[model samples]
Target: MKLCILCAKQRAVLKRPKTGQQICQACFYHVFETEIHHTIVDAKLFRRGERVAIGASGGKDSTVLAHVMKQLNEQYDYGLDLFLLSVDEGITGYRDDSLETVKRNQQQYELPLKIVSYGDLYGWTMDDIVREVGLKNNCTYCGVFRRQALDRGAVMLGVDHIVTGHNADDIAETVLMNIFRGDIARLGRCTEIVTQGESSIRRSKPFKYTYEKEIVMYAYFKKLDYFSTECIYSPNAYRGYARTFLKDLESVRPSAIVDIIHSGEAFEIKSTVKMPSQKTCERCGYMSSNDTCKACVLLEGLNRGLPQLGIGKESRVRKQIAESEQKELPTVVQHFSQIQRDADAPDIIQPRDPSTVYTPPPRMPTGVLDPPTKKTLDW
Candidate 1:
């Protein structure tokens, strides 16, 4: 029987993808959890008495993340009040079943669970969206909506920080995707262990350096309950291709994932490159680079029966919105305006009319748009 390289006395059960080291179950769990703990400490991700929300998707990464966060919080006496925060995208079978797993995790981990749905937040579910927009660009709506959903959920939970289960493979894939697409703004921050954006509540990736394989092995060994099915509506074709390529490279060299992340980290954008400045969405009061947030723009498209409004060029989306404005589609504008207007004011204060909502004008920032080239929208 093969013995663990680290323990020498125990039977080897798995091989680590990052180092290709044969390790026993106990040693594997120790190293896996320890590495994440180190990442949290090195990044200074938490403080005493801080309320943290784990962005649980019921998937392997998130399940393991919930477990590790609970374990380390107790082990290190971090004094953090942890909660499980989930976004119900309203995907029929997929998200529904996955959320059940998150529910079980809540019971097992003893963390307060809060679920925010797209229907409640946006008046549209992924099911309604896919039927209207079709499969071509539906993911765009889900992606944009889900992002804001998490933040909104955190707000309701009153958490100080949000943690996601983005592992090294996911980050590495994102790094490659950003490079291939020449998204300088995203490439700059994609490798960051923590991303606080302009929102008051910070969001971080504690598993930034952990490998997916180790996370799965850890779950397997510990018998952690998690959902493994992929999102039904997720085409994920573009990302899947990148993921496959990264996996192939990993088969050849285990260190490729970490190496790519390091390379992404080493990249320094030239001083001349202009980046998008963060601004509050005029419609929703959310952090956005454009005059309006992407979610609001996409919702406008769906509500107006012109689903293509925000899927392509910003110029096209603007022209469409302008044309719609000339036609006096007050319903479309008023709906989002009301949501944003109500959301902007503190909960303690009563909401006012949409007309009374005031947002500061957009300001120019340093980052340049992708050089004027015909590019296929990822959606």
Candidate 2:
């Protein structure tokens, strides 16, 4: 067998996809971890004493990410208080099974784990949403809700930054998806290593440049336990087409993944383009591109028997709303800021009693009622 390319010692084991170098297991591990460390350092992804939450999905990428984040935090003296944060979308047999893996990882890595569920946060689970919306457009509710759920979970954890396991291939697929959709705004920013949410919670991808193959190899050789299952609801997602296309290109040229990311990074939007401005959601106080956040709009649709309210053109949704008889819209259970405050002092209030009756207060003249102090029917 040929010797390792880097050490010229042990026999070569596997060839890396990014560099096409044959190396031993030890060398592979060293380079894999080193490259990620460099990415973090070069991007200045963390502060010395910041509390960081790893967005653990119990999948291969996330399981590997939690292990590596803990390893690097200790080995390089990153001084980061790392925690595992997971969003429970309440998908039966899928998310439920995967969370068990995350729980085991929490124990193995000895990091604090916080799980926020859709049922608890938004009063609607994935199963329920799917049942209501059917197979079509169910992903829209999930994507919007999960994004906000993670942010809210991070806030409750009081974390300074949230890091996900989005790898090079994932980033490349996203670039292709944005280009195909002609989403100029998302296309311009999708390649960024780090992004700040409207709430100022920083999110980064430490594995932004890491290959998915390498991550799989590392997990396999290390004998790490991780869940490997496609989300049952995402079989028809548009991103799947983009992913398949990118993989085809990668089969022809291994460098296609990194090249796509670099291309996205280099592509600049013209100043004349009109980008959506960020605003605070009037309902929940979350940052949104519209007056109401997508989550709120979707929930409204679900509650009002208008599941397509946020699925298509805003003008059509408005027309539908105007055509229907006016009814009292649901009020948010709690404000985002109030939730943060409650998180800071866990004993300040008692949990809402499920037995209590919910009466929708009279609608304000402004039409946007303030968040109810008591829980709503959904809650």
Candidate 3:
């Protein structure tokens, strides 16, 4: 039996993928958690008393991340008010099942949970999307909607920052995918540990340097409840090819994942190569490189019964919209700023007199703003 390298007492349980160290379960837990703590501290991922949301999906990576984050915060006195934020894509057999696990985690972790469904936000669901645009390019709609859904959920929760479970392996796969597609702009920032959108709400990866295998190991040893099933519609994803190649490379060379991330970080775009500038979407006020955000465009395509409007080339899509008989397309019901204002407003409290009747104010008319009942506070 191999003795533990860190303690030299207990038997070694497993070999770490990031470092080829044979260590006991206790040491593995220590090093695995300590490294994440170091990453957070070194990157300044959080500030004292900041409300941070864990982008929980109930998958192994996200489950382990929530558990570790809560553990670290309590053990190290990070002074963070943590919450669980989930996006319900409305996949019947997939997301629906996983979300139950998230609910259980909410109870187990004693953290407030908020779920923002696609149907509620966009008047469509993954089921609705798949039914409209069959299997091909359906992931595009799901990806775009889910990204904005998370952002919208964060806004609703009024969190200062959001942390996702994207680990080194996921980042490595993204780096390779960007390189394969020659997306220079995305390749430039895909490996960043932190990112912020137009709303200035920060998004980060606390497990940016962690390994998938170690994450699984940590979850297993800790007996965490997580859903491990893959989305049924992901068989045809473009990223699968890059993931396969990356896994094959890792089998031969364990450090390939970290190396690819390092390479992505080291890449420098030339001054001559033009990068797309960020702009607000005219339809929904979300950040976009074009006039309309991808979510708004895709939603319009679905609503117009022309699901192919946002699928292909930009020129062709624009031409299709131009040739269409409809003079005006539907815009999002509310802008992002309005959503933020609603989220920041405090809940109305009941009057102090119990016997006295309390009549609530009539609902405001459409397109009209309500009078503030209390002093307005800025986020």
Candidate 4:
């Protein structure tokens, strides 16, 4: 048997991808937890007596994160009050099973657990949404809803910060996806260790630099109680492509994941390019780029039987809304005519009585009284 490189006493169990050093299982556990601790300390992820929530999905990444966070909190005397926050997407078999795992995690880790459901928050389940929207872009709805759901869940738990299980591989894959889609804004932020949206609770990824393979190996060797199953509703074809590409690159060069993350961190978007401005959703009062948040827009579509409303380009959705409003203009104009108008704009004609308005035919310009069409157009 190969001897452990670090201790040289125990038998080697695995070779680290980040550093191709053969180490024993005990050494692997220590280093894995220590690196995450170092990442947290270096980034200053938490403070004394701060209430934090672990965005636990019961998956290997999240499970390992929970284990490591508890270990570090106790060992380093971080004085953190930790809780497990989970979002139930209302998937029948998928989230249901995963939530059971989260419950078990709560008991095993002895942390307070809180779960929020999509059906309760948005009045729609993933099943209902998939049926209404079909499988084509269901992931969009799920992603948008899940983000807001997590924030809401964190609020319910009264956490100051939220930690997620996003690993280096996930960050690298997101970087590739953002670059491929030309999403300059996301590309710039995808590599950050912490992200605070408009929500009060700050969200961070302590495992931002940790490798997924190492996480799996850690869980396996430690025999960590965690769930290992793919989301039933997640086809994730687009991100899957990026993930596959990144994994393939990793297979050839183990450092590719960290390198991509570094590249993403190095990106400096030009100041000239306009990025989306954050605003509160008019309907739900959630953080959104538009007047209405994506979740609200999508929920409106589903409720109005126009499920395709927020699926595509924002311009296209706006156009559809404008066209629909135009189709009902006569009724709208009649309804609004009862309201008083400004006295300064007496020339502003109201369409209350169409027949009372005088119509003029088009006149041909012939002299100095009328400017040429080309000259008018130029002006």
Best by lDDT: 3
Q: Which ten residues in a row have the lowest lDDT in candidate 1?
A: 360-369
Candidate 1 lDDT tens digits, 1-379: 6678998998776666667676777888888888889999989999899989899988888988999999999999999988888899998867876777777777788777888789888888999998998887888788788888888777767778999999999999999999899899999999998787434789899988888777766776677777776777665556878999998998778799999999999999999999999887877777889878898888878888888889887998888888885452332222222333123211221223424333222221211112324232110
Q: Report lDDT (CA) for all predictions.
A: 0.78, 0.82, 0.83, 0.76
lDDT of 4: 0.76
Specify the poorest-scoring 10-residue window by lDDT in model 4: 328-337
> Mind giving the per-residue lDDT tens digits that candidate 4 earns over 141-208?
98898888887766655678999999999999999999898888788788889888545678899999
> Candidate 3: what lDDT?
0.83
Per-residue lDDT for 223 in model 4? Answer: 74
Model 3, range 35-113, lDDT digits (tens) per residue? 9999999999999999898999989888999999999999999999998888999998788777777877887887878
Q: Candidate 1's C-alpha lDDT?
A: 0.78
Error of 4 at 181 (Å): 0.6
Tell me the lDDT of model 3 at 194: 94
> Which TM-score value belongs to model 3?
0.89
Clashing pairs in 4: none
Q: Local error of candidate 4 at 269, Å? A: 0.9
By lDDT, the better pick of 1 and 3 is 3
Work out the TM-score per prediction: 0.86, 0.89, 0.89, 0.84
lDDT of 2 by residue, 25-97 (tens): 8998999999999999999999999989899998889989999999999999999998888899999978877
